[model samples]
Target: AQSVAQPEDQVNVAEGNPLTVKCTYSVSGNPYLFWYVQYPNRGLQFLLKYITGDNLVKGSYGFEAEFNKSQTSFHLKKPSALVSDSALYFCAVRDRADYKLSFGAGTTVTVRA
Candidate 1:
């Protein structure tokens, strides 16, 4: 079985400061990791993915994630966060053997000016 965990329930950051959302996963084999963000009353939007290749993957909205195989982690990071970056973030993982995806409980990010 595959599962993802967001250790922090919430993360707070100020405008123009670095923001990070922690995530770790466990899978039977190699995993397909993904990060998604959802704003109020909106569906989850794909932020980035680590399907293969580089250890660092960049995605929408100036976000990027580093895939650490040994640590089983794929934390999302933004060098400078904006007030608009505040949202609910999710970390998901899918095993190559399965079609379903397992998601974390979600972490809420609050960015203030």
Candidate 2:
């Protein structure tokens, strides 16, 4: 079985400061990690994915993630935060045998002016 954990329920950041959302996972085999952002009343939008390659992967909206296999963690980071960047972020993992992705509870980011 594969599972993902978002340790924090919410992250608050200043408008111009950086932000990070942490995620950890457990899987039987190699894990396929992904990050998605959801706006109010809208579907989740793909942010980035770490399939295979360099440990560092960059994605939409100036977001990047570092895949640390040893730690079983994939944390999303943004150099500069924005008020519009406030939304719900989710970390997901896909198991080799499963066709669907299992998502974390979700982390809500609040950017204060």
Candidate 3:
């Protein structure tokens, strides 16, 4: 079984500052981790993924994530924050055997101008 945990319910960041959203996962074998973002009244958009190779993977919108095998974590990061970056972020872990992604509860980010 695979599961994802996003410890924070909400994250608050100011414009121009670096931001991070923590995530952890559990899976049988090598985990296929992913990050997604959802805007108000819209579907979830794929942000990034860690299917294989490098532990650090870059994604859309100046976002990146570090895959830690030991800690079983994949934390999301951004160099600079923007007010428009505020959205609902999610961490998902794909079931290796099934190829279905199981998402976390989601973390809401509010970037103040």
- Highest TM-score against the true fold, candidate: 1
For candidate 1, the 10 contiguous residues with the lowest summed lDDT are: 44-53
User: Distance (Å) between predicted and true CA of 25, model 2?
Assistant: 0.3
Model 2 poorest 10 in a row by lDDT: 94-103
lDDT of 1 by residue, 13-105 (tens): 999999999999999999999999999999999999999999999999999999999999999999999999999999999998899999999
Q: Cα lDDT for residue 41, model 3?
A: 100
Candidate 3 lDDT tens digits, 45-102: 9999998999999999999999999999999999999999999999999866776888
**Model 1, residue pairs in steric clash:** none
Tell me the spans in candidate 1 whose CA falls farther than 4 Å from its real position. Answer: none
**Clash pairs detected, candidate 3:** none
The clash numbers for all candidates, in the given order, read 0, 0, 0
Root-mean-square deviation of candidate 3: 0.8
Instruction: Score residue 66 of candidate 2 by CA lDDT.
Output: 99
